[model samples]
Target chain A: MRSRALALPMAAVLALSACTGALSDTGSLLGRDTLRIGVKADQPGLGLRGPSGEFTGFDVDVALDIAERLGVEPADVEFVEVTSAEREEALREGRVDMVVATYSITPARKTEVTFAGPYYVAHQDILVRADERSIDDVRDLAGRRLCQGEGSNSATRVIGERGVAARLIEAPTYSECVTMLEEGEVDAVSTDDLILAGFLLRSRDAFRIVNAPFTDEKYGVGVAEGDLSGCEAVNRAITDMYQDGTAEALLRMWFGDTGLDLVTSVPQFEGCS
Target chain B: MTAEAPPRPDRPTARSRAAERARRAAGRTTVRVWTLTAACLVGIAVLFAVTTGAIAQARDGFQVIGHGAGPKVAATADLYFALSDMDAQVANVLLMGDEHDLGAGREEALRRYEQRRDDADSALLHAAQLAEGDDAEQENVRAVLDGLGDYEQLVAEARLLNDEAGGGAGQPPAAVVDRYREATDLMRLELLPKAYNLTLESGATVRATYEDRRSATRLGPVWVALSGAAAAGALIALQLYLSARFRRRYNPALVVATAGVVGLVGLATLMLDDQAQQLRTAKEDGLDSVLALSRARAISTNMNADQSRWLLDPERADTYAQGFLEDAQTVLYVEDAAGEVPGDLAGYGAEVDDAVTERGGYRGRMLGFLGEEVRDAPLAGQAAAQQEVLRAYDGFLRADRDMRLIAESGREREAVSAHMGGAGSVEDAFDRYEEALIELTDLHRDTFDEAVRAGDDGAAGWDVLLPAACLAFAVLVLAGVRPRLAEYR
Candidate 1:
């Protein structure tokens, strides 16, 4: 009788313990049947949620391609929505095995996540209402409310390094910022030309990019900081994607009709090892 | 819970014996009732603490969102942008020789320069006000403000030297170059770094406040609710147990206590639920907008620096050529590459032919981000601005080719002349392109506030309601329990 009573308490303790998962200090990205790849669900061309609840975007395509290269079936790659602010957290928490969002590789970010292959290089540019003609260049930015998204240091470079006297506004996503611009809440939205093109193509609004890109941004795949093998594998996939005519094909497939400079040339890859 | 023992005459009869047993049972039940009462009070106290703590956290989070992340970050972004623009204006002045000699052009550049400088001053003032207390931010702003005065004097001296040199077709005197170089160095290394530091500090502050708001302890609500429910359940069971044991239909005090405890549990749950909802909305919607603006400003600032570098270092001709080419190709998707400049102008003609052949499409821009002779690129004319960019770039590339030819013949002076000369010069072509870029940059600047408005709007309703909800929770518990305590009395 006593043994049974103790067994009940032990089972209760076991039940409570089940609530706490293993305390993993870093991502233990072992081989699994399904790989959870985090991406932006709101960034239209890079990562977007479709009507069918499936994700579609350049990042999604890239992630799919990488999965194929990893010997994992494309159908097995699970997509998770990750925002700019949550990228590091998601990786650290092991909520996703890899991040294929339009992740920019920077030294500061390297502290939290390892990056693989800068598969594409994007330049910083501005988007304005189609009829807006008074603003055309970076120099004309004084006294304007520029909308940019959070969690990355993309906007400060323009204001801090360039010395444009502009007001700064923040948004959670590029799409929402575009909505603000459309609503006349903000005068302009600025980001990578590639991202802006995605917005323009999907927005169905009269928005145009002011053919002036100022900074070079190298887009890389992000993995948890300690996951060296995963980072290396991602880099390999990117290189293969470029070599096998896949990257060019993908760009044309998604961005060919957008009037964006769809140069199919693979971007310079950053160091992997 | 407390009850008096009734006076009983000893008898074996049913009535007297029953009364005596009932009294004994009531005395024991009183002790159990008091224990439950203490347990209920402990649960309520814990609930009070949890809810109140959450309220304080919400208050702090709201304050930081309102005061620190709100206007302060926006002002800092402006301050940083203005300082860089001012530096660019100075570069423009340097690029234009003898501000008084160029008729209408002179006046226009001077007017724009002065206006830009004024904007910088105003932005600095605004940033200082925003950064009033923080030692690091203040220090950085002060350094930039102080450095600007000296930078202006150096620019003036350089302009004077260039004017005295008759803004010659040939390279200006070494002294003039030295003066300009000094000014550029000061802006690049000293003033700009300080401005960037100020921006970094501001960004850090905003992120810190955001993290604090997001990192609020949730331990309070979940635990409090659990304890509260358990306490209420215990109170109800105690009331039922006492009524059955004492042979009474109901103990009014115990009944009231049980109801009061249950009500307190509901109120606590309600309060926490409200807080949780508000916190989620604030983070997802409001703070996100602030972060977006921060990114746009940083990118623009970096691009501005690249533009300045193109003009500041004319000596590194090939480097500038390649940098400009890559920057153009990356954005405009222009398929043009700077062919190898021959050893001593021997291969200049061949290089020109190669460029002309490559200029038609994406075949000219580097492929594989590293490969040469990239091909099969997209066409231009997506937007009017885009067309304008292509035109300016085409004009500049042609001009750059001419400069290359001049540079090759070993006539370094003639090359320098073509490099920085007026009208159709490499410098002039780039100026046009940069003008377009500035216009684009200006358009985005005005959007910084509106981007985050929706998020801010969602968060605005969160701040004032949290404390009131918590207070309501406490009040509801008090009103429900007070009558029960009086029944005990």
Candidate 2:
């Protein structure tokens, strides 16, 4: 009877030992089969959801490619609508696997997650009514009302760093910024050069980008912390795409005569430190 | 012999006495041995539990450091690079946009701006990915991209207007220039910051992650060491008890159990030690070194871009470039004087000085080149200097491109420019600058990788050791327990 009693405890101990081994397995953490990606739903040429609810854009294409590489089919991937303010939080809290949003890589963001690729490049520029010829430089907007997304780096640069004493009007989206400019609610809208090109093309005679840009903004793919393997894989894919002329082809397709140039032949990994 | 023995009334029968003594001794030893074995078994189990806990803690520590803090640092570095690239592109675009010369000079500037624009967009995309929040940030980014598209279209129209007005004549109409200026101003004032904040958002997240990872990883090792000691102690006690009870020097079961506990404890300790060492090295070499070098490179890029812009419109561009240079100098000073240059900056001090001297020489030559032109005559020599600058910039860019290629290809060259001296017809001076930056980036990367490897290696070692120790302690306990069964039998 005593021996039997001891055997029960011994079995319990062995069971517990097995549990420890299972607990130590790191593979479970890596199993992110169905990934949720945060991306822009409005920006044409970069990221926009179609009528069929399929996301497409230069940035979207890159994101999709990355998903495909991760063994997830395009249909299996879920797209989460995201904005500049929400992207970081969504990524940090595990709400999304990656953000393919036309997000700019900056010193402030390196603190949150691992970033891969400078998939696209753009410059911050001003958009104005085509006929209006008064404003010549960022400095001339001292008294003009400038529209840009709130919490955006463009607003910060115009209102804070560049010291353009413009009446800073915050918009919810780039379209809103453009609308404000069109409606004369604001004198101008600030954003990336190629995006401004798309808007101007749509507007035709309505708006134009200023000759000078205020800043350069490089777009990257974001992954959760410690996901270096994922980061590396995505970076390699981007680099391969660049080398294979996939990036150039995509750029040509979206931005016809906007004259956007591809700077690096491969996507470079700028370590977050 | 015993059967033949006669009974003695005083001593009793020999066989009966011997049997009685043996029975009493056996009973006493059996009881004692069983108690000792039970105690040893309990000790071994407790030790194993403690050791296992310690090893688990060590693993957790490794995770926090490797996956958490390490990533945060890497991400932050990326953010800085992105922001710097953005700033540089903006400067370049503005410079290009300001150029009124409709010939080759104007086209070159536009081409350069377009290239820079592409770079900025790519950086922004990466930043967006790193940024956390919800769809709000993504929406904001999309909005900015749209706004920028509008801005570029406007610039293109203005460029066309200027070209028509120029008609290959002496100069374009001031009105056309004004139109171009207006378009350029709108884009710069309205659209640029929307993109820049994306970077700021990314930087903020990077800072938070770094702090969290650092704290979490720091606490893992102590827990592991304590648990390991407990397991080892239990195993030793079990072995002693088994030896004493068995009265035979070697108790196989007890020996196995003791060995198991000792092995487990030893392994756990080793793993913890290695991880701790790795974390320390990463902090000292990788994080710090990479941060400093990246900061310097970012600043330098920003300055160079501003310089390119200033060269386009000497009057206004110069001022902006000067401000950018000051900022760059500040970054350099912080990197150099803050004692963060990763080892002695003394060795590279001479090289840095030489680069600075070369920069000064170039500036002087540029000034003389510009002075020869009539100040009032439509900035004629600007085309020449613009071409020179373009050549130099492209040279630098090509070098940078090659360096990235080399790094990606895993070809570890001490200096980047060593391999690509013949790819382009670039000035040797510009090549040197590009090479220097590449070298700096590579040096820091190497240091960071070494630290990471150390940490990983340490964790791997611990992974092996902790399990071994647990098995050893278990064996020792089993060895100790087996002797008690013999006594019971």
Those runs of model 1 whose alpha carbons end farther than 4 Å from true positions after fitting are A1-273, B1-21, B27-42, B98-108, B111-142, B163-174, B217-313, B316-489
DockQ of each two-chain model: 0.02, 0.02
B-chain TM-score for every candidate = 0.58, 0.59
What residue runs in model 2 are displaced by over 4 Å at the alpha carbon?
A1-31, A128-173, A176-188, A201-211, A225-229, A259-269, B1-275, B282-489
lDDT of 2 by residue, A17-135 (tens): 55643443322213467778899888876777789888877777777777876677788788888877789888878788889887877533654667776676576778898777998
Error of 1 at B114 (Å): 4.1
Q: Best-fitting candidate, measured by TM-score?
A: 1
Model 2 Cα lDDT, one tens digit per residue, B109-161: 45656665675566556545654453544654565567667766765665566
Model 1 DockQ vs. reference: 0.02
Q: On residues B129-183, what C-alpha lDDT tens digit does candidate 1 reach at each position?
A: 7677865457656767878888889979977877777663334556776886777
Where does the lowest 10-residue lDDT sum fall in candidate 1 chain A?
A: A17-26
Docking class of 2: incorrect
